[model samples]
Target: MHVGILYSRIRRDEKLLLNELRDRGHEVEKIDVRKQQFGLDRMTTDVSELDLVIDRCLATSRSLYATEFLDSYGVTVINNPRTADICADKAKNSLALAEAGVPTPNTKVAFTTDAALEAIEEFGYPCVLKPVVGSWGRLMAKIDSRNAAEAILEHKATLGHYEHKVFYVQEFVDKPGRDIRVLATDGEPVAAMTRSSEHWLTNAAKGGKTAAFELDETALDLVETASDAVGDGLLGIDLMEVGGAGSGEYTVHEVNHTVEFKALNDSTDVDVPARVVDWLETKAAESDAAEAPIA
Candidate 1:
Protein backbone atom coordinates (compact mmCIF):
# COMPACT_ATOMS: atom_id res chain seq x y z
CA MET A 1 0.00 0.00 0.00
CA HIS A 2 1.16 3.56 -0.72
CA VAL A 3 0.74 6.05 2.15
CA GLY A 4 1.37 9.78 2.11
CA ILE A 5 2.11 11.49 5.42
CA LEU A 6 1.10 15.13 5.36
CA TYR A 7 3.16 17.13 7.86
CA SER A 8 5.04 20.39 8.40
CA ARG A 9 7.42 18.94 10.98
CA ILE A 10 7.81 15.29 11.82
CA ARG A 11 7.51 14.87 15.57
CA ARG A 12 8.16 11.68 17.56
CA ASP A 13 4.51 10.66 17.19
CA GLU A 14 4.81 10.84 13.43
CA LYS A 15 8.17 9.05 13.50
CA LEU A 16 6.66 6.10 15.33
CA LEU A 17 3.90 5.69 12.79
CA LEU A 18 6.33 6.15 9.91
CA ASN A 19 8.69 3.47 11.27
CA GLU A 20 5.81 1.07 11.73
CA LEU A 21 4.58 1.58 8.21
CA ARG A 22 8.06 1.12 6.76
CA ASP A 23 8.78 -1.99 8.83
CA ARG A 24 5.63 -3.51 7.40
CA GLY A 25 6.91 -2.89 3.82
CA HIS A 26 4.39 -0.19 2.96
CA GLU A 27 5.50 2.52 0.48
CA VAL A 28 5.47 5.86 2.34
CA GLU A 29 5.53 9.33 0.78
CA LYS A 30 6.48 12.30 2.90
CA ILE A 31 4.50 15.29 1.69
CA ASP A 32 5.68 18.41 3.53
CA VAL A 33 2.89 20.94 3.38
CA ARG A 34 5.31 23.88 3.52
CA LYS A 35 7.14 22.87 0.33
CA GLN A 36 3.97 22.21 -1.62
CA GLN A 37 1.67 24.63 -3.38
CA PHE A 38 -2.05 23.85 -3.73
CA GLY A 39 -4.88 25.47 -5.65
CA LEU A 40 -8.43 24.80 -6.73
CA ASP A 41 -7.18 23.49 -10.09
CA ARG A 42 -3.80 22.01 -9.18
CA MET A 43 -1.53 20.63 -6.43
CA THR A 44 2.16 19.66 -6.18
CA THR A 45 1.88 15.95 -5.54
CA ASP A 46 0.22 13.08 -7.40
CA VAL A 47 -2.15 12.32 -4.52
CA SER A 48 -4.42 10.23 -6.71
CA GLU A 49 -2.08 7.24 -6.63
CA LEU A 50 -1.69 7.13 -2.83
CA ASP A 51 -3.84 4.67 -0.96
CA LEU A 52 -4.11 7.01 2.05
CA VAL A 53 -2.76 10.27 3.47
CA ILE A 54 -2.52 10.67 7.23
CA ASP A 55 -2.71 14.31 8.33
CA ARG A 56 0.03 15.14 10.84
CA CYS A 57 0.32 18.89 10.41
CA LEU A 58 1.06 20.62 13.73
CA ALA A 59 -0.79 23.81 12.92
CA THR A 60 -4.59 23.48 12.95
CA SER A 61 -4.94 25.85 10.00
CA ARG A 62 -2.45 23.90 7.89
CA SER A 63 -4.07 20.59 8.77
CA LEU A 64 -7.50 21.86 7.76
CA TYR A 65 -6.38 23.37 4.45
CA ALA A 66 -3.98 20.59 3.47
CA THR A 67 -6.63 17.96 4.01
CA GLU A 68 -9.18 20.06 2.22
CA PHE A 69 -6.90 20.33 -0.82
CA LEU A 70 -6.11 16.60 -0.83
CA ASP A 71 -9.80 15.76 -0.50
CA SER A 72 -10.58 18.08 -3.41
CA TYR A 73 -8.01 16.17 -5.49
CA GLY A 74 -9.87 12.92 -4.73
CA VAL A 75 -7.30 11.51 -2.29
CA THR A 76 -8.21 9.56 0.82
CA VAL A 77 -7.18 11.14 4.14
CA ILE A 78 -7.63 9.89 7.64
CA ASN A 79 -9.65 11.93 10.15
CA ASN A 80 -11.37 13.40 7.09
CA PRO A 81 -11.65 17.11 6.42
CA ARG A 82 -15.20 17.11 7.75
CA THR A 83 -14.02 15.72 11.08
CA ALA A 84 -11.08 18.13 11.17
CA ASP A 85 -13.44 21.03 10.49
CA ILE A 86 -15.55 20.12 13.52
CA CYS A 87 -12.70 19.09 15.87
CA ALA A 88 -10.35 21.99 15.11
CA ASP A 89 -12.33 24.57 17.10
CA LYS A 90 -13.11 24.35 20.82
CA ALA A 91 -16.63 25.72 20.36
CA LYS A 92 -17.50 23.11 17.73
CA ASN A 93 -15.99 20.30 19.80
CA SER A 94 -18.13 21.20 22.81
CA LEU A 95 -21.31 21.55 20.76
CA ALA A 96 -20.80 18.18 19.04
CA LEU A 97 -20.52 16.46 22.41
CA ALA A 98 -23.54 18.20 23.95
CA GLU A 99 -25.75 17.75 20.90
CA ALA A 100 -24.96 14.01 20.91
CA GLY A 101 -26.17 13.74 24.54
CA VAL A 102 -22.65 13.13 25.78
CA PRO A 103 -21.99 14.56 29.25
CA THR A 104 -19.59 17.46 28.72
CA PRO A 105 -18.63 20.37 30.97
CA ASN A 106 -21.17 23.19 30.88
CA THR A 107 -19.95 25.66 28.25
CA LYS A 108 -20.99 28.98 26.72
CA VAL A 109 -19.75 31.20 23.95
CA ALA A 110 -20.02 35.00 23.79
CA PHE A 111 -19.03 37.52 21.15
CA THR A 112 -18.16 40.53 23.31
CA THR A 113 -16.36 41.12 26.57
CA ASP A 114 -19.53 42.28 28.32
CA ALA A 115 -21.39 39.17 27.23
CA ALA A 116 -18.47 37.01 28.31
CA LEU A 117 -18.42 38.78 31.66
CA GLU A 118 -22.07 37.94 32.11
CA ALA A 119 -21.37 34.29 31.32
CA ILE A 120 -18.40 34.20 33.67
CA GLU A 121 -20.51 35.75 36.39
CA GLU A 122 -23.29 33.26 35.83
CA PHE A 123 -20.90 30.35 36.08
CA GLY A 124 -19.40 32.12 39.10
CA TYR A 125 -15.72 32.32 39.97
CA PRO A 126 -13.05 29.76 39.02
CA CYS A 127 -14.41 28.84 35.62
CA VAL A 128 -12.20 28.42 32.55
CA LEU A 129 -11.57 30.77 29.62
CA LYS A 130 -10.04 29.10 26.57
CA PRO A 131 -9.01 30.12 23.08
CA VAL A 132 -11.29 28.70 20.38
CA VAL A 133 -8.40 27.14 18.40
CA GLY A 134 -5.59 25.79 20.59
CA SER A 135 -4.13 22.71 22.18
CA TRP A 136 -1.71 21.62 24.95
CA GLY A 137 -3.45 23.97 27.40
CA ARG A 138 -1.88 27.16 26.06
CA LEU A 139 -3.79 30.44 26.73
CA MET A 140 -6.29 28.68 29.00
CA ALA A 141 -7.04 30.87 32.01
CA LYS A 142 -8.76 29.89 35.21
CA ILE A 143 -10.75 33.03 35.93
CA ASP A 144 -10.88 32.70 39.71
CA SER A 145 -12.45 36.02 40.67
CA ARG A 146 -14.38 38.98 39.34
CA ASN A 147 -11.19 41.03 39.18
CA ALA A 148 -9.35 38.35 37.20
CA ALA A 149 -12.31 37.85 34.90
CA GLU A 150 -12.44 41.53 34.03
CA ALA A 151 -8.72 41.68 33.32
CA ILE A 152 -8.73 38.59 31.07
CA LEU A 153 -11.82 39.75 29.24
CA GLU A 154 -10.25 43.14 28.63
CA HIS A 155 -7.10 41.53 27.27
CA LYS A 156 -8.99 39.23 24.91
CA ALA A 157 -11.25 42.05 23.68
CA THR A 158 -8.20 44.06 22.66
CA LEU A 159 -6.64 41.33 20.54
CA GLY A 160 -7.06 41.98 16.81
CA HIS A 161 -8.06 38.44 15.80
CA TYR A 162 -11.74 37.54 15.77
CA GLU A 163 -11.03 34.24 17.54
CA HIS A 164 -9.60 36.05 20.53
CA LYS A 165 -12.84 37.98 20.86
CA VAL A 166 -14.89 34.79 20.69
CA PHE A 167 -14.84 33.90 24.37
CA TYR A 168 -15.16 30.19 25.27
CA VAL A 169 -16.12 29.72 28.88
CA GLN A 170 -16.68 26.42 30.67
CA GLU A 171 -17.56 25.31 34.17
CA PHE A 172 -14.37 23.86 35.63
CA VAL A 173 -14.73 20.28 36.71
CA ASP A 174 -12.78 19.58 39.87
CA LYS A 175 -10.80 16.66 38.59
CA PRO A 176 -8.97 14.63 41.21
CA GLY A 177 -5.43 15.66 40.31
CA ARG A 178 -5.73 13.80 36.98
CA ASP A 179 -7.62 13.28 33.73
CA ILE A 180 -7.80 10.47 31.21
CA ARG A 181 -6.75 10.29 27.52
CA VAL A 182 -8.14 7.41 25.57
CA LEU A 183 -6.84 6.86 22.01
CA ALA A 184 -9.65 5.36 20.01
CA THR A 185 -10.32 4.36 16.38
CA ASP A 186 -13.87 4.52 15.15
CA GLY A 187 -15.30 4.46 18.68
CA GLU A 188 -13.07 1.60 19.85
CA PRO A 189 -10.39 2.04 22.48
CA VAL A 190 -6.78 1.21 21.53
CA ALA A 191 -5.30 2.16 24.92
CA ALA A 192 -5.98 4.50 27.83
CA MET A 193 -3.82 6.58 30.20
CA THR A 194 -4.28 8.93 33.14
CA ARG A 195 -2.45 12.27 33.02
CA SER A 196 -1.94 13.54 36.56
CA SER A 197 -0.60 16.86 37.76
CA GLU A 198 -0.94 19.03 40.84
CA HIS A 199 -1.75 22.05 38.71
CA TRP A 200 -5.17 22.68 37.15
CA LEU A 201 -3.89 22.05 33.60
CA THR A 202 -2.99 18.38 33.31
CA ASN A 203 -2.23 18.03 29.62
CA ALA A 204 0.87 15.94 28.92
CA ALA A 205 2.33 18.92 27.09
CA LYS A 206 1.94 20.83 30.39
CA GLY A 207 4.11 18.39 32.39
CA GLY A 208 1.36 15.98 33.37
CA LYS A 209 2.51 12.54 34.60
CA THR A 210 1.01 9.55 32.84
CA ALA A 211 0.30 5.90 33.53
CA ALA A 212 -1.85 3.19 32.04
CA PHE A 213 -5.51 3.38 33.05
CA GLU A 214 -8.15 0.69 33.13
CA LEU A 215 -11.44 2.01 31.85
CA ASP A 216 -14.70 0.96 33.43
CA GLU A 217 -17.84 0.31 31.41
CA THR A 218 -19.10 3.86 31.88
CA ALA A 219 -15.87 5.38 30.66
CA LEU A 220 -15.91 3.11 27.63
CA ASP A 221 -19.47 4.16 26.87
CA LEU A 222 -18.60 7.87 26.95
CA VAL A 223 -15.55 7.24 24.75
CA GLU A 224 -17.72 5.62 22.11
CA THR A 225 -20.33 8.39 22.33
CA ALA A 226 -17.75 11.17 22.04
CA SER A 227 -16.03 9.44 19.11
CA ASP A 228 -19.32 9.17 17.21
CA ALA A 229 -20.15 12.77 18.08
CA VAL A 230 -16.96 13.92 16.34
CA GLY A 231 -17.53 11.50 13.42
CA ASP A 232 -14.95 9.03 14.75
CA GLY A 233 -11.44 8.90 13.38
CA LEU A 234 -8.15 8.42 15.15
CA LEU A 235 -9.36 10.43 18.16
CA GLY A 236 -8.19 11.46 21.58
CA ILE A 237 -11.23 11.47 23.87
CA ASP A 238 -10.50 13.43 27.07
CA LEU A 239 -12.48 12.74 30.24
CA MET A 240 -12.43 14.02 33.82
CA GLU A 241 -13.83 12.41 36.92
CA VAL A 242 -17.26 13.53 38.07
CA GLY A 243 -19.29 12.73 41.26
CA GLY A 244 -16.08 13.50 43.17
CA ALA A 245 -12.53 12.17 42.76
CA GLY A 246 -12.34 8.50 41.85
CA SER A 247 -16.14 8.33 41.96
CA GLY A 248 -16.27 6.53 38.59
CA GLU A 249 -18.58 9.06 36.95
CA TYR A 250 -16.95 10.90 33.99
CA THR A 251 -17.54 14.01 31.91
CA VAL A 252 -15.89 14.18 28.50
CA HIS A 253 -14.33 17.58 27.90
CA GLU A 254 -12.97 17.30 24.34
CA VAL A 255 -12.19 15.09 21.38
CA ASN A 256 -8.93 15.59 19.49
CA HIS A 257 -8.15 15.03 15.78
CA THR A 258 -4.49 14.55 14.74
CA VAL A 259 -4.08 13.23 18.31
CA GLU A 260 -0.47 12.74 19.48
CA PHE A 261 0.13 9.37 21.09
CA LYS A 262 3.90 9.25 21.88
CA ALA A 263 3.12 9.71 25.58
CA LEU A 264 0.47 7.04 25.36
CA ASN A 265 2.98 4.65 23.72
CA ASP A 266 5.58 5.34 26.42
CA SER A 267 3.23 4.82 29.38
CA THR A 268 1.50 1.66 28.18
CA ASP A 269 2.47 -1.78 26.86
CA VAL A 270 0.22 -1.39 23.86
CA ASP A 271 1.98 -1.24 20.46
CA VAL A 272 0.29 2.04 19.68
CA PRO A 273 1.79 2.59 16.24
CA ALA A 274 1.12 -0.94 15.12
CA ARG A 275 -2.51 -0.67 16.11
CA VAL A 276 -2.86 2.63 14.29
CA VAL A 277 -1.30 1.15 11.15
CA ASP A 278 -3.64 -1.82 11.38
CA TRP A 279 -6.51 0.62 11.21
CA LEU A 280 -4.85 2.50 8.34
CA GLU A 281 -4.52 -0.68 6.33
CA THR A 282 -8.20 -1.37 6.84
CA LYS A 283 -9.03 2.15 5.69
CA ALA A 284 -6.86 1.76 2.61
CA ALA A 285 -8.56 -1.47 1.61
CA GLU A 286 -11.96 0.13 2.05
CA SER A 287 -10.97 3.05 -0.15
CA ASP A 288 -9.61 0.75 -2.81
CA ALA A 289 -12.74 -1.37 -2.78
CA ALA A 290 -14.99 1.64 -3.09
CA GLU A 291 -13.02 2.94 -6.08
CA ALA A 292 -12.48 -0.38 -7.84
CA PRO A 293 -13.92 -0.82 -11.34
CA ILE A 294 -17.05 -2.97 -11.48
CA ALA A 295 -16.78 -6.46 -12.98
Candidate 2:
Protein backbone atom coordinates (compact mmCIF):
# COMPACT_ATOMS: atom_id res chain seq x y z
CA MET A 1 0.00 0.00 0.00
CA HIS A 2 1.13 3.55 -0.66
CA VAL A 3 1.21 5.78 2.42
CA GLY A 4 1.92 9.49 2.64
CA ILE A 5 3.27 10.96 5.85
CA LEU A 6 2.34 14.65 6.12
CA TYR A 7 4.80 16.45 8.35
CA SER A 8 6.78 19.67 8.71
CA ARG A 9 9.73 18.05 10.48
CA ILE A 10 10.84 14.46 10.99
CA ARG A 11 10.85 14.10 14.75
CA ARG A 12 11.91 10.88 16.51
CA ASP A 13 8.28 9.73 16.58
CA GLU A 14 7.92 10.22 12.83
CA LYS A 15 11.24 8.48 12.26
CA LEU A 16 10.05 5.40 14.10
CA LEU A 17 6.92 5.23 11.95
CA LEU A 18 8.89 5.78 8.75
CA ASN A 19 11.37 3.06 9.63
CA GLU A 20 8.57 0.64 10.48
CA LEU A 21 6.65 1.31 7.28
CA ARG A 22 9.82 0.89 5.17
CA ASP A 23 10.74 -2.34 6.96
CA ARG A 24 7.35 -3.73 6.03
CA GLY A 25 8.04 -2.88 2.35
CA HIS A 26 5.20 -0.40 2.12
CA GLU A 27 5.66 2.46 -0.31
CA VAL A 28 5.96 5.61 1.82
CA GLU A 29 5.85 9.23 0.68
CA LYS A 30 7.01 11.98 3.00
CA ILE A 31 5.11 15.17 2.20
CA ASP A 32 6.57 18.19 3.94
CA VAL A 33 3.78 20.69 4.63
CA ARG A 34 6.20 23.63 4.85
CA LYS A 35 7.14 23.30 1.18
CA GLN A 36 3.72 22.38 -0.21
CA GLN A 37 1.01 24.71 -1.45
CA PHE A 38 -2.67 23.72 -1.27
CA GLY A 39 -4.90 25.14 -3.97
CA LEU A 40 -8.69 25.27 -3.65
CA ASP A 41 -9.22 22.24 -5.91
CA ARG A 42 -5.82 20.60 -5.66
CA MET A 43 -2.39 20.68 -3.97
CA THR A 44 1.15 21.16 -5.22
CA THR A 45 1.93 17.66 -3.89
CA ASP A 46 0.15 14.88 -5.78
CA VAL A 47 -1.49 12.47 -3.34
CA SER A 48 -3.72 10.69 -5.84
CA GLU A 49 -1.66 7.49 -5.79
CA LEU A 50 -1.46 7.30 -2.00
CA ASP A 51 -3.69 4.76 -0.29
CA LEU A 52 -3.60 6.69 2.98
CA VAL A 53 -2.17 9.94 4.35
CA ILE A 54 -1.20 10.19 7.99
CA ASP A 55 -1.49 13.67 9.51
CA ARG A 56 1.73 14.07 11.47
CA CYS A 57 2.35 17.81 11.28
CA LEU A 58 3.69 19.12 14.61
CA ALA A 59 1.89 22.42 14.40
CA THR A 60 -1.87 22.19 15.10
CA SER A 61 -2.68 24.99 12.63
CA ARG A 62 -0.72 23.29 9.87
CA SER A 63 -2.23 19.91 10.68
CA LEU A 64 -5.78 21.23 10.59
CA TYR A 65 -5.41 23.19 7.36
CA ALA A 66 -3.32 20.60 5.54
CA THR A 67 -5.64 17.72 6.45
CA GLU A 68 -8.69 19.77 5.53
CA PHE A 69 -7.18 20.55 2.15
CA LEU A 70 -6.16 16.95 1.54
CA ASP A 71 -9.64 15.81 2.53
CA SER A 72 -11.19 18.30 0.11
CA TYR A 73 -8.98 16.89 -2.67
CA GLY A 74 -10.64 13.46 -2.17
CA VAL A 75 -7.58 11.93 -0.53
CA THR A 76 -8.04 9.72 2.51
CA VAL A 77 -6.43 11.32 5.56
CA ILE A 78 -6.33 9.61 8.95
CA ASN A 79 -8.07 11.45 11.76
CA ASN A 80 -10.12 13.23 9.08
CA PRO A 81 -10.53 17.00 9.16
CA ARG A 82 -13.61 16.85 11.36
CA THR A 83 -11.70 14.93 14.02
CA ALA A 84 -8.76 17.29 13.65
CA ASP A 85 -11.02 20.30 14.03
CA ILE A 86 -12.46 19.01 17.31
CA CYS A 87 -9.19 17.78 18.81
CA ALA A 88 -7.09 20.82 17.82
CA ASP A 89 -8.91 23.19 20.17
CA LYS A 90 -9.20 22.74 23.94
CA ALA A 91 -12.73 24.17 24.07
CA LYS A 92 -13.95 21.80 21.37
CA ASN A 93 -12.15 18.86 22.94
CA SER A 94 -13.80 19.44 26.30
CA LEU A 95 -17.23 19.96 24.82
CA ALA A 96 -17.01 16.78 22.75
CA LEU A 97 -16.02 14.73 25.80
CA ALA A 98 -18.75 16.24 27.99
CA GLU A 99 -21.37 15.93 25.28
CA ALA A 100 -20.53 12.24 24.95
CA GLY A 101 -20.89 11.77 28.74
CA VAL A 102 -17.23 11.02 29.24
CA PRO A 103 -16.03 12.04 32.69
CA THR A 104 -13.68 14.95 32.01
CA PRO A 105 -12.29 17.71 34.19
CA ASN A 106 -14.87 20.41 34.86
CA THR A 107 -13.71 23.04 32.37
CA LYS A 108 -14.76 26.63 31.73
CA VAL A 109 -13.84 28.90 28.86
CA ALA A 110 -13.98 32.68 28.78
CA PHE A 111 -13.15 35.14 26.05
CA THR A 112 -12.07 38.11 28.21
CA THR A 113 -9.81 38.54 31.21
CA ASP A 114 -12.64 39.62 33.51
CA ALA A 115 -14.81 36.65 32.62
CA ALA A 116 -11.76 34.40 32.81
CA LEU A 117 -10.99 35.71 36.25
CA GLU A 118 -14.50 34.84 37.27
CA ALA A 119 -14.02 31.29 35.93
CA ILE A 120 -10.74 30.93 37.84
CA GLU A 121 -12.44 32.13 41.00
CA GLU A 122 -15.27 29.66 40.43
CA PHE A 123 -12.88 26.76 40.04
CA GLY A 124 -10.92 28.19 43.01
CA TYR A 125 -7.20 28.13 43.71
CA PRO A 126 -4.91 25.33 42.54
CA CYS A 127 -6.91 25.02 39.33
CA VAL A 128 -5.31 24.89 35.93
CA LEU A 129 -5.02 27.56 33.21
CA LYS A 130 -4.11 26.20 29.77
CA PRO A 131 -3.69 27.61 26.31
CA VAL A 132 -6.60 26.80 24.02
CA VAL A 133 -4.32 25.04 21.53
CA GLY A 134 -1.08 23.45 22.77
CA SER A 135 0.55 20.20 23.80
CA TRP A 136 3.46 18.81 25.90
CA GLY A 137 2.24 20.86 28.87
CA ARG A 138 3.45 24.19 27.43
CA LEU A 139 1.72 27.44 28.51
CA MET A 140 -0.18 25.67 31.30
CA ALA A 141 -0.35 27.17 34.78
CA LYS A 142 -1.40 25.68 38.08
CA ILE A 143 -2.91 28.76 39.64
CA ASP A 144 -2.39 28.39 43.38
CA SER A 145 -3.70 31.75 44.45
CA ARG A 146 -5.99 34.62 43.42
CA ASN A 147 -2.97 36.88 42.84
CA ALA A 148 -1.42 34.34 40.50
CA ALA A 149 -4.67 34.06 38.57
CA GLU A 150 -4.89 37.83 38.20
CA ALA A 151 -1.30 38.07 37.02
CA ILE A 152 -1.59 35.20 34.54
CA LEU A 153 -4.84 36.52 33.17
CA GLU A 154 -3.27 39.94 32.82
CA HIS A 155 -0.36 38.48 30.88
CA LYS A 156 -2.65 36.50 28.62
CA ALA A 157 -4.90 39.51 28.06
CA THR A 158 -1.93 41.53 26.86
CA LEU A 159 -0.88 38.87 24.36
CA GLY A 160 -1.89 39.75 20.81
CA HIS A 161 -3.22 36.34 19.79
CA TYR A 162 -6.93 35.61 20.18
CA GLU A 163 -6.17 32.14 21.60
CA HIS A 164 -4.45 33.66 24.61
CA LYS A 165 -7.59 35.70 25.27
CA VAL A 166 -9.64 32.49 25.20
CA PHE A 167 -8.82 31.25 28.69
CA TYR A 168 -9.28 27.50 29.38
CA VAL A 169 -9.64 26.81 33.06
CA GLN A 170 -10.19 23.39 34.62
CA GLU A 171 -10.62 22.04 38.11
CA PHE A 172 -7.33 20.48 39.08
CA VAL A 173 -7.38 16.73 39.60
CA ASP A 174 -5.13 15.66 42.46
CA LYS A 175 -3.89 12.70 40.48
CA PRO A 176 -1.39 10.97 42.75
CA GLY A 177 1.60 12.57 41.10
CA ARG A 178 0.93 10.71 37.86
CA ASP A 179 -1.42 10.44 34.89
CA ILE A 180 -2.10 7.83 32.26
CA ARG A 181 -1.47 8.15 28.51
CA VAL A 182 -3.12 5.45 26.46
CA LEU A 183 -2.32 5.16 22.76
CA ALA A 184 -5.39 3.87 21.00
CA THR A 185 -6.18 3.11 17.36
CA ASP A 186 -9.84 3.53 16.49
CA GLY A 187 -10.81 3.18 20.16
CA GLU A 188 -8.59 0.15 20.68
CA PRO A 189 -5.63 0.25 23.06
CA VAL A 190 -2.18 -0.09 21.57
CA ALA A 191 -0.43 0.29 24.93
CA ALA A 192 -0.67 2.29 28.12
CA MET A 193 1.88 4.15 30.28
CA THR A 194 1.96 6.27 33.39
CA ARG A 195 3.76 9.61 33.47
CA SER A 196 4.86 10.44 36.99
CA SER A 197 6.51 13.62 38.23
CA GLU A 198 6.62 15.67 41.41
CA HIS A 199 5.39 18.71 39.48
CA TRP A 200 1.73 19.24 38.63
CA LEU A 201 2.44 18.84 34.91
CA THR A 202 3.58 15.26 34.36
CA ASN A 203 3.93 15.24 30.59
CA ALA A 204 6.76 13.09 29.28
CA ALA A 205 8.00 16.21 27.47
CA LYS A 206 8.09 17.88 30.89
CA GLY A 207 10.62 15.34 32.30
CA GLY A 208 8.04 12.95 33.70
CA LYS A 209 9.17 9.43 34.55
CA THR A 210 7.39 6.69 32.60
CA ALA A 211 6.33 3.11 33.32
CA ALA A 212 4.10 0.54 31.68
CA PHE A 213 0.60 0.59 33.15
CA GLU A 214 -2.01 -2.15 33.19
CA LEU A 215 -5.40 -0.66 32.37
CA ASP A 216 -8.36 -1.83 34.38
CA GLU A 217 -11.80 -2.33 32.85
CA THR A 218 -12.89 1.18 33.79
CA ALA A 219 -9.85 2.76 32.18
CA LEU A 220 -10.31 0.63 29.08
CA ASP A 221 -13.89 1.81 28.83
CA LEU A 222 -13.02 5.48 29.22
CA VAL A 223 -10.29 5.19 26.62
CA GLU A 224 -12.78 3.83 24.07
CA THR A 225 -15.47 6.39 24.93
CA ALA A 226 -13.06 9.32 24.84
CA SER A 227 -11.67 8.16 21.51
CA ASP A 228 -15.17 7.95 20.01
CA ALA A 229 -16.12 11.31 21.51
CA VAL A 230 -13.42 13.08 19.51
CA GLY A 231 -13.79 10.91 16.34
CA ASP A 232 -11.42 8.01 16.69
CA GLY A 233 -8.19 7.61 14.84
CA LEU A 234 -4.69 7.18 16.19
CA LEU A 235 -5.15 9.03 19.48
CA GLY A 236 -3.54 9.72 22.84
CA ILE A 237 -6.22 9.63 25.53
CA ASP A 238 -5.09 11.25 28.81
CA LEU A 239 -6.82 10.22 32.01
CA MET A 240 -6.31 11.32 35.60
CA GLU A 241 -7.25 9.12 38.55
CA VAL A 242 -10.02 10.66 40.56
CA GLY A 243 -8.91 8.86 43.72
CA GLY A 244 -5.55 7.07 43.44
CA ALA A 245 -3.66 4.90 41.03
CA GLY A 246 -5.51 1.71 41.96
CA SER A 247 -8.80 3.55 42.15
CA GLY A 248 -11.10 2.56 39.32
CA GLU A 249 -12.46 6.08 38.86
CA TYR A 250 -10.96 8.20 36.09
CA THR A 251 -11.59 11.44 34.21
CA VAL A 252 -10.23 11.83 30.68
CA HIS A 253 -8.54 15.20 30.34
CA GLU A 254 -7.79 15.27 26.63
CA VAL A 255 -7.69 13.37 23.34
CA ASN A 256 -4.76 14.18 21.06
CA HIS A 257 -5.15 13.78 17.28
CA THR A 258 -1.54 14.01 16.18
CA VAL A 259 -0.26 11.89 19.09
CA GLU A 260 3.46 11.19 19.55
CA PHE A 261 4.43 7.76 20.86
CA LYS A 262 8.23 7.47 21.03
CA ALA A 263 7.99 7.92 24.77
CA LEU A 264 5.28 5.28 24.98
CA ASN A 265 7.33 2.87 22.89
CA ASP A 266 10.28 3.30 25.27
CA SER A 267 8.16 2.87 28.38
CA THR A 268 6.42 -0.35 27.31
CA ASP A 269 7.58 -3.71 26.00
CA VAL A 270 5.04 -3.41 23.20
CA ASP A 271 6.34 -2.80 19.65
CA VAL A 272 4.43 0.48 19.43
CA PRO A 273 5.30 1.45 15.89
CA ALA A 274 4.58 -2.04 14.59
CA ARG A 275 1.10 -2.03 16.13
CA VAL A 276 0.42 1.43 14.69
CA VAL A 277 1.49 0.22 11.26
CA ASP A 278 -0.80 -2.76 11.55
CA TRP A 279 -3.70 -0.41 12.15
CA LEU A 280 -2.63 1.76 9.25
CA GLU A 281 -2.67 -1.22 6.91
CA THR A 282 -6.15 -2.14 8.05
CA LYS A 283 -7.45 1.39 7.50
CA ALA A 284 -5.88 1.60 4.06
CA ALA A 285 -7.42 -1.72 3.00
CA GLU A 286 -10.80 -0.54 4.26
CA SER A 287 -10.52 2.62 2.22
CA ASP A 288 -9.62 0.65 -0.88
CA ALA A 289 -12.49 -1.73 -0.41
CA ALA A 290 -14.89 1.16 -0.02
CA GLU A 291 -13.71 2.73 -3.26
CA ALA A 292 -13.67 -0.47 -5.32
CA PRO A 293 -15.86 -0.43 -8.43
CA ILE A 294 -19.18 -2.28 -8.12
CA ALA A 295 -19.57 -5.55 -9.96
Candidate 2 global CA lDDT score: 0.94
Estimate, for each residue in 8-76, the C-alpha lDDT of model 2 and write its tens digit: 889999999999999999999999999999999888888999999999999999999999999998899
lDDT by residue for model 1 (1-295), tens: 9999999999999999999999999999999988989989567877878999999999999999988988888888888998999899999999999999999999999999999999999999789999999999999999999999999999988888989999999998999999999999999999999999999999999999999999999999999999999888999999999876668899999999999999999999999999999999999999999999999
The runs of at least 3 residues in candidate 1 whose Cα sits more than 4 Å from the true structure, single-residue gaps closed, are none
In model 2, the runs with Cα more than 4 Å from the true position are none
Candidate 2's TM-score: 0.99
